[model samples]
Target: MIPVQEREQTDDRRSAWAVFLVFLRLGLTSFGGPVAHLGYFREAFVTRRRWLSERAYSDIVALCQFLPGPASSQVGMVIGLSRAGYRGALAAWLGFTMPSAIVLVVLAMGLSGAGNQVPAGLLHGLKVAAVAVVAQAVWGMARSLCPDAPRLTLMALAATAVMLAPSPWCQVAVMVAAGLAGARWFRPAQAQAHEPLPIPVGHGAAIGFLLAFFVLLVGLPIAHRLFPGQWLAMADAFYRAGALVFGGGHVVLPLLQAAVVPTGWVDNDIFLAGYGAAQAVPGPLFTFAAFLGGAMRAEPSGWVGGMLCLVAIFAPSFLLVFGALPFWERLRRNAGAQAALAGVNAAVVGLLVAALYQPVWTSAIHAPADVALALLALVALAAWRVPPWLVVLACALAGWGLAPS
Candidate 1:
């Protein structure tokens, strides 16, 4: 088995910096959505840079997909953190999310119905870009993880389930359950595999960080309900939303709408409009929470308040993923565990597939031109070896002209 780089060696400033820049570029240039983000990721990380082995990358992706909270985005964070530590992860995450946050905030101030408008053609092109991006991800993941009929079927089922329920959290839960079941029942015979990456030092600290976050996530909300106005309430709302979020960004809408509308934060119009705009932008959708928070401007108002809301929403995920990552090596190879993961992974694939179709595809593919544009984008990626970033841009233009939202 090839020796994966030691943590100490991989955790260099240069590595982290590279990841930061890459994600930053992605946040600014990549279009469509999370599914598209994944495609751009593959084109850059898996295919272009060769940062991770195919299996290693796919495993991480599969795990993220099965769990929730912007699977692709989380996967990127995990990868960055794994290579560089807390700061590395932070840089990568911030770079990826900051652009969207900035855009959302700026746009938030302009939603007075008299906001400057763009040509419908441009919005439609963006949709085309989204379609192309998902197709790229589906192709890459299929080749890597779902190489066989059974695996493909598993992924298909996951997508179908999502189409039926359209509930992100449920989708994640289904995948997790399936993965755990697969690990238990279908453990592959032990063989030589990549040597486990060294656990980042002080596994205890990682666990503690995770435990503390979760405790607050569940505990603070109840405390807030009982004793409102304190930081606990703020923490509770954000953490609960973070904990429950499956697909991230747009998925956060339905859950958030229920939470805030009842509390008299913002009406449905603001919530849905922000969500749609979030889709139109290039960065993390969680930043929509930032926009919503800014709009709320209740107690912890202004940029600081928005930051708090955003931090609270994303904190649990950051903690949980890091805490679990140190142990992923141990878990991934365990037979009983592998059996469960197999099932879950398949379901995750399916869920992702469904997501690709609905929010990703349905939103964009409205015309025969869209179909053509998507096909051409695929050809560029699968055939001509073009960067996904370019494909997304081209498709966005095509969508703007052809479909003209």
Candidate 2:
């Protein structure tokens, strides 16, 4: 770790307040999606600030990617934790999450009744932009994480399974099994050994909370079957969706689409529309839940329903990550347990690979234009050094001009 005085002397000497403000700015300025958000994070924290060494940052990325949650959001939490513990985590999360959630709320409320007030061309363009951003992420992730043939094979297998089944239960089970198998059998190309668990603090509490919440969700539907059809029914759908989610955010998209859109809780076009907009905003794509909830024209429109969706999707993840983290250390010290986690972490990578293909890549790539756009977005990102927001905006305009919804 960089020493404290030296840390203070670093060029980007942001105070706690300054850090929050910086993230807040990052949140607002973040318009493309998570891949772009990664770019932004690298620019602000690594290149500009040098707040963390490359090794420490990579370790955090490894840990975040190994765990089940939104990749960008988890990284934000780790950065916050590293910078200022719990408070930093909260600030980063809030700063990252709130902007997107708030924007979606507005769209959910106003657009529900307004119909296609957003130009069809605009929506189409945004969809194409969304595809570009997701593809960029997949390429970046594959480059960094899945280096060897075993990991690549695992990723391919996982993606195929999800594209076929698209079930949460199926996804999580695969992740667990893969991790176990990797620990027992697979080796990194260099023959380096893997750490069993690299989760941060509060992991146990997070798991306990998930258990308690799961019980409430399952039991409440069974017990209050007589209650308003709306409340209990909503609980069941969201709860089931949460239970089965594996890779978080994008992984949950198919499940959410199945639950809310097809069931008539939300219109299909509206769902895709919300998804397009979700890409243009910061924070987890799972917050698209807000669009589903608010557009249902629920009693508590705008923020209330949007907040409900936000909580339903993410609360479980926070519990799982922090709760699972603390005991993971103990598990690491045990050779067998470490062995198991070693397998688990490798499996987690497989699951991530599967997710990137099934939902993240497939859903977004709808056309040849989309493929070209995605490639161009990556080129601009990796080669030309153009800012992401600009790429997103330009692609959105291009999509509108070339392909109208």
Candidate 3:
């Protein structure tokens, strides 16, 4: 008979593998961005698998939302970590992230090779679709996050500030200012008691992860300046974008635009087109990084660049989730922290609003027909409740049809 220890080890491996398989399915099929991804996760893990109690699941979601990164992706990582330790976390991330990342990278490469052959109408349609998607996000987030007058006012101010300044540092500063304003003025409603999370990480390990997160955040830029390699610079830019953005995948847009577009690393058209295509795929929207990486004008611009960017952007999420899980209980319970987070969330909505106007709106909406298409896309997304991927496909066809013969 197998020894008891050996049997237990085998079981652990099986558990990790199971986690990966489940999330791989999710990666392939889950759509509609972060909020929808959360619903898919809830159905798969809580209702179907009964992996954890509803409260426990919610608590995990809250913790991830409270921290920076893609909330849905972080939620998946936490669920996996709870089930089978660190190995399980890695498996979950790989399974959920890879499908979308791979798709975007391949798409980017194809667009690059297609060059002048790619239909202008199709590309334009994708940009129009992006405008609608960002508008929907802004609308939805406004309703949920800016319900109160104070928060609404804060959101408008943040939007105005971002639009006026329009830089990565400006965006980060706005979030910080909003958080401070929230801590001072906003009083968060008392939180409901939550079930304790089942994360297996200890405080020491958590601290180590947290330290690593900061070290990389600070060290990457300095290293890039000193070494000045293309790969290092790309890693630094992607890492900073991943680490700083408070909201989910959509909020990363302006930061990413600033990072790649100005440096002549990626053209504005390619960047926006990739973003538009990202909406059509499953899993996290952050996989747009893969597209940008693959489409870069310089060396390491194919699969190698794509993988580097995918890893760099997502690295912080892993570190933050692992680091924060242990201390999340106390942090969540802190009223001040909750209030500040509320403000930060409000700011996130505003930041998205600015992005909608500048890059998404200005780039896509050139004529009356484009406006009409955007309006229709928004209606389809927000009112008809049509699935996003379907809407994206329809828009692509419409754009192609409208192209000058």
Candidate 4:
């Protein structure tokens, strides 16, 4: 008979393979934005694979939702962590993100010179699809995060505040205010007892990872400023965007656009076009960075830039997840933490709501046909249960066909 340690190691290896294959399939098929990704995860991991219990999965979702990174990616990591170990987490993220990143990078490289020659209607259609996706996310998240009157009120206030004075700092401030409000007002009537969720890494490792995350967050930009290199600037820009953006992958749009476009690293048209192209692909929207990097007129363009930016943008998610996992087990059990998370989740929904209106809706719905296309996409997603990839394809084709003569 095999030794216990050897058996465990064998099991872990198998689990890692399972994680890779599962998330790779998801990378190929999952769509409709981050919130929709969460629903897919729940269906796959919780209902189908039984990798985590529904309660544990929901708790993990709550934890990721409140944190300042890509929530779906974080949740995927946590699921991977629970299933196998750190190796599984890496496998999950790589498998789920690489497909879209590769697609976008290739698109950027191939279409760098296409410019106005490319069909504007197809791009517009993807943007309209994005509108439907984000709107669906807002509706679903609102139901879960703001089901109560107090939470609903908090969400409204958060949404109103950000809509009126839209900026990164404004987003941060609203999240902070919401958390405080939750802690003060949304505390549970009775403390609930629960088992701690398992994290493969111990607290000591978590602390080291957390420290490294902060060091990179603070140190990268300073080093770039001092040393002045294209690669360093690129790394700093992507890293800062990854570290700072609060809501999700979509929320990083403006931050990333500001980072690359104004600096003349990537053209505005290429950036926006990549964003539109990103919507048609599966996996995380953060892969949009890969496209921008590849499409950049600056040095390090091509695969080098694409891979570098992709890794830089996603590195923080790994660090943040590893760092927080140990503490998450404790935080979930605390009434104050739960209350604060509730507030933050509501605020996140509001942020999604706000995002759907501005960059997504305003940019997408330029005409009556655009509005109709978006509404139909919404129906396809929310009502017909048509797969997102099919919806994206349909929208793209429809946009191409419907382009004004």
Best by lDDT: 3
The true-structure Cα RMSD of candidate 2 reads 5.5
RMSD over all Cα atoms, model 1: 6.8
Cα shift from native, residue 19, model 3 (Å): 0.1
Give the clashing residue pairs of candidate 4, or none. Answer: none
Q: Tell me model 1's lDDT, rounded to 2 decimals.
A: 0.65
Number of residue pairs clashing in candidate 2, backbone atoms closer than 3 angstroms, sequence gap of 3 or more or interchain: 18
Worst 10 residues of 4 by lDDT: 189-198
lDDT of 4 by residue, 1-405 (tens): 998755654764447888999999999988878878999999987786666788888878877876777889989998888887888899899889999999999999877767677787776666777778777777877887789999888888887887898776687788899889988888775444444666778889999999999999999989998999999999998988788777787678766866787789886556655676687888998999899889988889889999999999988988988998778757766888878877887887787777777667777788888888989998998899787778777887888888886
Task: Assess every candidate by TM-score.
Answer: 0.64, 0.72, 0.96, 0.85
Summarize candidate 2's per-residue lDDT along 1-405 as a digit string, tens digits. 998757665744434555677788887877555556677888878777776666556545554555555767777776775676667777777787888788888877777877767666655666566555555556665665466777677667766776677665676677667667676665434322333323345555566766876686567668557675665566566666655554446556666766776568877666765766676566677778777788884454467667776766665555555554455444434455434444554444455555445444555667787788768877886678676557767876876777643
lDDT of 3 by residue, 128-227 (tens): 9999999999999999999999999999999999999999999989999999999998887877767876678899999999999999999999999899
Models, CA RMSD each: 6.8, 5.5, 3.6, 3.9
Q: Each candidate's lDDT (Cα)?
A: 0.65, 0.64, 0.92, 0.82
Error of 3 at 239 (Å): 0.4
Model 1 residue 15 lDDT score? 63
Q: Give the TM-score of candidate 2.
A: 0.72
Predicted structure 2: lDDT: 0.64
- What is candidate 1's lDDT per residue for 1-405, written digit by digit as tens? 434554523543446787798889988987656767778888876676666667777767755754547676787787677667777678878888888887766655554233337455654665565556556656665676666777777777666766777654665566676665566556567633443443353689878977887688668857878887835655666667777655445545545655665677654445444554565667666777777766563666446656777888888778777777766666665666556655755664565576567666666666677688878977887789776556655765665556423
